[model samples]
Target: MDSGQISIGQIRRSEHLPARIAAQLAAQITEGHLKPGERLPTEHSLSKTLGVSRSVVREAIAQLRNEGLVETRQGVGAFVSEKCARPIRIKDEELGDPQSFRALFQLRVPLEIEAAGLAALHHTAEDLARIDEALAGMTGAEKWTHQGVEADLLFHRAVAEATQNEYFAMFVGFIAERISHAIDAARARAVLEEIVEVTIAEHVVLRDAIASRDPKRARQAMRTHLLGAASRINLSLEEF
Candidate 1:
């Protein structure tokens, strides 16, 4: 039972605790701090060291396992996979910084614009319905709360799904999840009523463009909405 000297520090309570823990462990594995075939510290040990519950440690390990970074042998323990391939990820800290946050939006803009265009060409009635439902949720959400953020994400995801491309949906979901905290932070800093009203209005325009089957207008509308969103957060995406 060699619990190697893994230097994981105690984590503060946060909404993304499991993800934060997973990212730290992934970094260690990728940097060769944790060797291939080396067993990870026991869940109990990790919980104690990280100052989190065992369930949190378990969830973190599950995330690593899903990424092919760890293997769990029932009755034995979790070990680093023999061939550890690094997976693409956006670190939580990156979203907290202005430059990295802007960079991520730079990546998001083009993909979402293209998705909007394709969705305009391909979306079914059901897709439109889902988009409408999410929009309605956003309209009714309490100011700057988690519910508002979730509804906003759902709208984007619905549009991505309307593109009829699984990969678009997957990537949109990934990017949205990674940047959600930033979105929340931005909303918290802005005039709540004004931001909410302006955001929902932009979403309406984009939605109508897609529903009308106007691909060009849909793309332009999406571009406008995204740019406006950045502006609301006090981020200038004009040069990007």
Candidate 2:
């Protein structure tokens, strides 16, 4: 091979290697392989171990720093930030009380309702395609599980992405797991089966409203759907 020419494989591998290494290190932090406040290895050491260039290691560290996972001291090495290792835990005690859960639902309703409305106005064709794909997944009744819950969440996430707002997308992703947990908990109660059906049907309505670009209808439908869910969950909680 000529020194002036780049191999296709080299280019492809170069593109992927740094990100792969960064992600692996990040997983170590998030998964507790690297404890909070532990210093990272020097760039030279990390590069040798990961089989990447020193520049690649440096860039990876920069990315982690941006995510608040690591920090640097000018004369010293990089250290794991305390914020990086902890997972956000929504405790059983939080859900044990009806009032707290209701309050949570109250806060969630408006954020999503507004997001849906904005999505109807701003969604791209590709975003619509993603939404449709998730909807199709949900229609397969035999396949509904935690994965199904995720697909359902993805449909809403697609809408948030469609809104062309970064903060909305980030906020939606942040709440996605918590909302899924709460819904899954509620759904486990046999009394909430009807509520599940209603919820899926409302997703259909919400999807159609957004597809039609009817922002007002989309927002109102989402709000109504969520409020209805709150009511049913509350009723089941009362029984519990």
Candidate 3:
């Protein structure tokens, strides 16, 4: 086996050992390197292999079990659970992490860009009006407030609605709820502390792109606005 396969290197001394161990095992399981129901390496073997204590390995296995990623039977040690074959949900505790925020933002980029293009082709007068309402809500509200964040979410949600596809709207609505906290945090960041005017101006740019029914330009406008947003939030997404 490759040396990299056997270890996650030395965990930081102050880090949560159990969660770190669980994260490694969970990744292997999810990636199919550890197939569903396959027996996990014994606690003793894992402790030695990863250069951690047996107690740390044991606790990590317990954490995985709670997460539906693994199961343990008496005297048989842990095995990847059948649930590992399904899409796994991350714990609420992990949602606040920067990596998690980047993941959600990554998922948002394509959906939003495509939706903007579709909106240009299909949006109704009512859809345009709703989007403008959301924009006005943002422009009129105090910067960095929850109201501003809600308006921002509404602006995206309105674009999703304008796509004339129910599924697009539904999925974007789901994502908005999941990342509401991050939106709040991003809005309050000092780097974005004075970005209110810029934010509203960009929304106008997007609304006009769609209003003019230019699909290509709409997509580019949406992408540029969102990329700017990611920068304002200090989100480091190498793939973006």
Candidate 4:
């Protein structure tokens, strides 16, 4: 596999090939292989190259469209979507150390609490509906794996959206996703192993508080959740 290009095998193993392919390709664009307005390879060509059926390739392309990562020209091939330079990848190490795992929780506490507070204070009816939709998605997800994390993320993202600030929403979503990914990889530790359920329940607190539109309660709920998670980390941090 060329490190520069997304691999075909990777797509085949993807749980949601279409969406995953779209996100990967979009990342490539942000990372700079596909330039703005550059025509994507034809569906047939991509299908053959990626070893996926043409239908899969088309579906992936459609997923990219939803993300504003590509555009379809009537007679021409799909082109890389505009606003391609938006930097969305959030590296786990940014919170400073997966081994300790404490840093990740520490990083999440304050930022997310504040985001929740702001969201409650500013959210619109549409934003609340989005949160409700995300919450509804959490019902007995066969297992707390990929789907759980995605639904968890959707709930938090709705809070950010409620803030009505683009930067807040984008950065919060980016950081939360990275933090969640790191938490997922910490399965060897019992404390960290429960982080998914911990996170999901904590999110429900924020969601309910936000839905109530009481900023103070929302902030308090978020803060308490973060602090609880922070205390779970085995590592001690002097700064926090």
* Per-candidate local distance difference test: 0.82, 0.69, 0.76, 0.66
Model 1, 72: alpha-carbon shift in Å? 19
* Count of backbone collisions in candidate 1: 0
Worst 10 residues of 3 by lDDT: 83-92
- Provide TM-scores for the models: 0.68, 0.60, 0.59, 0.64
TM-score (C-alpha) between model 2 and the true structure: 0.60
Q: Which stretches of candidate 3 lie over 4 Å from their true place?
A: 1-91, 141-144, 191-193
lDDT of 2 by residue, 1-240 (tens): 111221112223534454455556766777777778888888876765666678767756754654456778998989888973433434335755777666656666777889999999999999999989888776667324655666776777788888999667656644553455566666787464565577789889999999999999999888877777676555322210
Instruction: List ranges where model 1 is wrong by over 4 Å.
Output: 1-87, 141-144, 238-240
Q: Write one digit per residue (lDDT tens) for candidate 1, span 1-240.
A: 244477778887865677788888988888888889888999988898788999878867865765567878998889888763534666777677888888888888999999999999999999999999988888884535767777888899899999999778767766776666767777788887788888888899999999999999999999998888788778877554
Q: Model 4, range 1-240, lDDT digits (tens) per residue?
A: 233255434465645555556666766777778878788888877776666778777767754653456778888878886774344343333445544355555665677778888898889999999998887675455335556656666777788789988667656665565555444444335553366667667778888889888889998888876665555544444443
Q: What ordering of candidates by lDDT runs from best to worst?
A: 1, 3, 2, 4
Better of 3 and 4 by lDDT: 3
Ranking by TM-score: 1, 4, 2, 3
Q: Tens digit of lDDT per residue, candidate 3, span 57-93?
A: 8867755664567778998778778962444456446
